[model samples]
Target chain A: MLKSRIIPCLDVNEGRVVKGVKFQNLRDAGDPVELSFHYQDQGADELVLLDVTATRQERIAMLETIERVRQRLSIPLTVGGGIGSIEDAGRLLNAGADKVSINSAAVRNPDLIAAMSARFGAQCTVVAIDAKKQGEIFQVLTRSGTTAEAIDAVAWAARAESLGAGEILLTSFDRDGTRSGYDLPMLSAVTDACSLPVIASGGADSVAHMVEAFQHGAHAVLAASIFHDANMTVGEVKQQLTDAGIQVRNEW
Target chain B: MIQIINTGVANIRSLQAAFDRLGCTWNLTVSPEDIATASHVVLPGVGAFAAAAEAIDQLGLRTAIIDRINHRESATLCICLGMQLLCESSEESQSAKGLGIIPMAITRFGDGVKIPQLGWNEVRPLDNGPYDAGEAYFANSYRLETAPDGWGAAETDYGGTFISSIWRGRTLACQFHPELSGTWGESVLTQWIEGITC
Candidate 1:
């Protein structure tokens, strides 16, 4: 049986783990390696080290962090943030990242998804979609959800899959840090839109939210706040999911 | 010491980390001598079939690996694409030749299921196989549908039943990643290191 993956995302800036309440005012959490150990100890299937502020030097810091953290990691690790080109993806992969996720760059030039997928194999090319629910539709946002785009979230996901993205990281900007729960309708919409596996992200406060995301058709649920705040371990979440009759990997 | 055959396509850092955590001594090698002479060899791979097959040949590891396997003195563990490389051939790359250890065809997952099936899938051992496999992480588009002759296998269900791991004598090849699968996965590496020959 294929299980729904539980991923804990670490918002990284300048190589340090930072958790921002709604993408504003970054606060240090801990070293990425330490936090990674924390999550994996609770049986996290994978880790996403998303570089929040992806400047030139910060990108290098991200690489360094990946290098150090990877030595300690046993599971898969995904590196994202300001990955503007194939070279950037290449650098991260070379630095020992198992996969690379593209956001703003993929939106600006959708072809990059095809190129990276072709170059690195579709297995490692992830397209992250930051979206906010607008009236009657979900609108895609960019640059850490500051700029709203005319692109439809569901439509972009379908296009991204067609353009060769292997997976979609659909984050809800409207619900992020709100503890409101995953945007279920938005999640199901994107899942229905694309054939690729969709990872539900943002605004999860409890195990029920994760269960809701899975029931809504997420192949995986990526939550940050709940894990970071010590509200639940990845083990606890999976235990609850299993109790709720959702198939989650328990042998790990 | 375990010699990990690095054919340039593999992200071996995590694999290496797994070994280190196990307190196992290992080395990354493209050297044929190392492949031929190591007590055990781990062929770790990531990426396309043709590219990986080409890299093995380019690094002059072809005959070396085959000879080592034939000798049956030690063992070789193939991981993911490494396992695919052991097959007769694949639908993915028509022109490329496999090492032909498994003597089976590798085909893509059906249209109904997602391609490049990522994340974890349950793995069960069959016919007195060495490892239990136990919910391993997988990331591949192509898979072996059935077990070949003279080998015990661990199977997984997706679009249908597919062989996830195969064991013969002391040798093992897994389609799923034991390195990235945490506890049970690390135990797979440990048993391989402990040399629990079937």
Candidate 2:
């Protein structure tokens, strides 16, 4: 059986990791390579580095950072944020990212998904959807969740899959950074809509929440604040999941 | 020296990074001469099988790699699409013919099993290969039905048991990406390198 994955997301702004990740052993929160190695030691299945401000110059810096991080560890590295075109994804992949995640750009041009999948293969293209509950339905949001579209979250997921997207990184805008729990309803809707692997992002406060996300059909669970703030370790989370009867990687 | 063949199908920087982390020296080469002189050769590829095989043949690496594996004592490791290219043929691209180093055909996962069996899966070593029975990361939509006779070194199950790694003489191939499979992957790679150099 395939084990559930635990991925920690690092938000990079202007070449530095932002939001102040406070690990006890890490003195520099801005060092992405250092933090990534530390996370690997703590048993993170994968690492996601998002350039929050992916400016023209920042993209270059992000590539350098990815190269540095890639040299330090052997785990899968996923790079995202401001990936608007096939060129953008290519640059990241060439820089040593195992996978590239596209969100706003994919929303703007749905066909980009197919183009990327065709060029890099679907396994390398990850379509990240930021969605929020609007009225009676979950609506897709873009531009950092400030702009909303009429597209239904579930339908969009199915469409992305049909377009050759290998996986979906579904982030619930309503529950993002809330530390409450995953939006089980939205997660269930998207997972039920598509057969592709679904990675649940946002609103994870405890180990139980991760288990719930798995129970809701998430193949992986991604967290930021809880892991970044040093509130819980990846090992503790994986151990909790293992104790709950979930098969998790035991390397850590 | 370790020579990583550049097929232009995927970036080899991650593989170089893996060697760098291990404090091992390697060269990225597309030249057949460099491949001929190397003690170990790594053929790593991604994307479509047809494209990769085309690139290998276009670059004249097919003859070079086959010669090294068949004649010289150099250990050759084929990864992912590189492994598929060693088979007889694949259903992915009908017009493309594999190198036929191994007399097996690659096929897509059958119905009821998810295409692109992604994530970490257990690999059971069927022989006295370097790899132990452990979980390694895998990302592929197709697989071989069974191991190629005595070459079956490791077998993994997704929809059913399939050959994940094969070892025949000095040649080794794996369907999973060891460079991206964390510590377990790194150790397996290190062992392969040692087996060749020592």
Instruction: Give the Å error, residue A189, model 1.
Output: 1.5
What would the per-residue lDDT of candidate 2 be over residues B11-113, giving only the tens digit for each residue?
6778899988888888888999988878889999888888888898899888888787666357888888888888879999988988887788899988765
Given candidate 1, what's the lDDT at residue B146? 92
lDDT of 2 by residue, A58-123 (tens): 778888999999999788888989998999899899999989999989988999999998888988
- Candidate 1 has what TM-score? 0.94
For candidate 2, give the lDDT of residue B139. 84
Residue B89 shift from truth in candidate 2, angstroms: 1.3
Model 2 ranges with Cα > 4 A deviation: B196-198
Q: How does model 2 score on DockQ?
A: 0.73
- Candidate 1, residues B137-164: lDDT per residue as tens digits? 8999999999988888889998889989
Q: Could you say which candidate leads in DockQ? A: 2
Q: Which stretches of candidate 1 lie over 4 Å from their true place?
A: A20-29
RMSD of each: 2.9, 1.6
Worst 10 residues of 1 chain B by lDDT: B66-75
